[model samples]
Target: MKSRKAFGKLLQKYLEGKCSESERQLVEQWYELIDEAPRQDYTEKEWEALEYKLWRKIESESFETADESIESSKLGFWRTYRTGIAASVALLIGAGVWWYLGNQDTNPATIATQPTQSEIAIQDNTSSKPIKIDLEDGSTVTLSPHSQLQYPNHFAANKREVQLRGEALFEVSKDPEKPFYVITNEVVTKVLGTSFYVRSVDATKKIEVEVITGKVSVYEKEKVNNENPGVVLTPNHKVTFFTVEKHFITGLVEKPLPQIKSISKKPETFEFDDAPIGEVLNKLERVYGIDIELENDKLSTCPLTADITQQPLYTKLDIICATINGKYEVKGTTILISGKGCE
Candidate 1:
C-alpha cells in the first residue's frame, strides 16, 4: 500500500492525466470530487475538468516537511498561494452548493426553471410578517408594511394573474399587451402597464385599487360551489371593494369620480356645479393635499379635474378654473373662485 503522502501525489498525477490506467482507476471514484460553477447549470465535461484541476493542485503539496505544507511553509510566496487556493476552494464550494440546490430533484416544479430566468413573486402580504422572496427573474421584491401580491413565472402565459394579501402595491413593468393581474385574497386587479395597490385580504376587509397610469381592472371575489369565480368592475376609477356576508362577496367596483382613460377617453367626466367651491378645494386636499400647497383664495372654489395630479397645484388649479370658464384670487387663508356661477 502506498503511504498517505505518496497516495496524494499519485492522485494528483492522475487528475492531471499523467497517471497510468491502473493509477487512474484508483482515483476514478474521486472523479466527481467537487465542481466549480459560474452559472446555474454547468456541463459535465466542464465539471470534470474543474475537479481534475483542483485535485492536481491539492496533490502537489509535499508532505516531507511541515515547512513545505503551504500553511506552515515559512516562505511568503508559498503561504500566499496556499491562502489563495483555500479561498478559491471556498468560493467554488459555495457556487456548487447554490447550483445543486437550484436543481434539487425534490423541487421538480422549481427545477425546470434555470436561475438565469427571473421569477415573479406573487403573494398577499398584509397585516403579517414580511415575505422574503428570491426570484428567478433577477428581480427582488419587498412587499409593503401590509400588502399582498401574486406573480407567476410567466405573466399572462395562460392566465396572467396574481393574488394579493392585504394592502400591497406593485411597481410593475410596461408590458405591451400581456397584462399583469393581481388577485387579493378576496379581490382581483388587472394591469397591462402601470403601478397600483390592492387591499382585500381578510373577508371583513375592504380593497382599494389606485392606478398611476396605464389601466387597471378591479373585480370582487365570487363564491361558487366548485366553479370558477366571477368579477364586475368600474374601469378608469380608483375603487374600494367591500365585503358581503353571503358566503362571499360579489359586486362591481364603483367610483366616486367620473371615469378617465388615456386611449379610450381623452377627457374626464365630473361637474362641480354651485357645489361648495370649498368642497372642490377639499377634493384636491384629499387627492394631493400632502403634495400640493393651497393657501388663501386657492382654498375657496378651487375647481380641478382631468389629469391635474402631476402638474404644480397652481398650474393644475389654473387649468381647472380655466376649463370651467372661471378664475381665482389668492388670499391669506382662502381662495375666491369667481368668473362664473361658482359663488
Candidate 2:
C-alpha cells in the first residue's frame, strides 16, 4: 500500500508538471522497476500490457495534437509500437485521403500495403446506409452506416473472424468445425454459423448483440468460471453487456419499430414481464410509426402488461400516450417521448 501510494503520488506530479528534474529521473527509474515487478506485487504480464496501453495513449495524443495539419487527419494514427526493448521505434505510414462511397467508407484508395490481418476499404458512406451481408453459410448481417467489411483476403480453414465497431447484422457462413467468431471489447461472439446483430458503440454499455436467427453464445474473455459471465441468446433475443456492470441479460422480444415498421398489419399485442427498453421503443417506432421514449432508465426495464393497439399510427400513439400517461413531440425527422415510467 505504501509503495502504491508513493507510485500514485509520483504519477500525479508527472502529470501536473510538478516533478523536479532529479525527482523526475527517480520517478522514471521507479516506473521501470514497477514495470517489471512480480505478479504478487505487479505481474510482468500486466506490465507489458500497461506499456502497450501507455504507448497507444501517447500515439493518440500525438495524432490529436496535430489539428494544425488538416491533411494529416487523413493520415491514420498507426505509429508502430515498440515490440521489444531492442526493437527500433518502427514507423509505418498508411496512405492518405479518406474516401466515402455512398454507405461504405474506404480509407486511402492506394495506401501502402502493410501486413494486416484484413483490410476493409470503405466505398462511400452517404445513403443506403447500413449494408446488409449474408455469408455463404446462411449467416445474415446488416453493416452499419459508414462501415467497411474486411475479411482475411480469404478465411482460413478453421475460423470465421471479423472485427466491428459501427454496427452489423451477421448471418454467419455456418461451419460447425470452424465456428464463426467475432472479437469486440474483450468479449467474443461464438456461433456455429447463426444469425445475429452487434452494435458496438455504447460507451457505457458499448455493445449490444441481438439474435435474429439461430442461437449464439456470448461471454467475457479470460474470466473466472464463478463470474458466470454470459448467456446463450435465441431468436428475438437481445443482450446489453456492460464491462463496468459485469452482467449481460436476455431481453424480452420486441415489436418492429417504424425503422423496421411495415404497413397494414395491425400492431400485434404482446406482454413483457421483463422486456428490454430497446425492443419496446423500436417496436413502437416500427409498428405504430411513432416514437416511444422512456425518460428514466429505471422505467426502461419496468414490466408492462398493456394491451397495445395496432390501429393507425396516430391512433396507436394516442392510445400509448394515454396508457403510459406521457407526451410525444416530433422534431424534423425524429420523434421524442417524455414522462411516464410506466404503470
Best prediction by lDDT: 2
After superposition, the stretches of candidate 1 with alpha carbons farther than 4 Å from their true spots are 1-142, 154-156, 201-204, 223-236, 245-343
Residue 55 miss distance in model 2 (angstroms): 25
lDDT of 1 at 318: 73
Stretches of candidate 2 exceeding 4 Å from the true structure: 1-128, 133-140, 146-150, 224-229, 256-343
Q: For residues 1-343, could you state the per-residue lDDT of candidate 1 as single tens digits? A: 2232344455446546798888665455333233332332334345446646765655553233564534653655654555455445434433343233222232323112222212433343444565554333333345765554445565434334454455554655655555555655455465655655555546556666765444665554433222443332322235566665323232222222223433555533234555444565655545432122333454454444455544554565676677556775543223445544332
lDDT of 2 by residue, 126-208 (tens): 35667666554455567778544444444457666665655777878667898777656546677886667877764556577
lDDT of 1 at 52: 62
Candidate 1: clashing residue pairs, number:
26
Q: Given candidate 1, what's the lDDT at residue 282? A: 58
Per-candidate TM-score against the hidden true structure: 0.34, 0.41
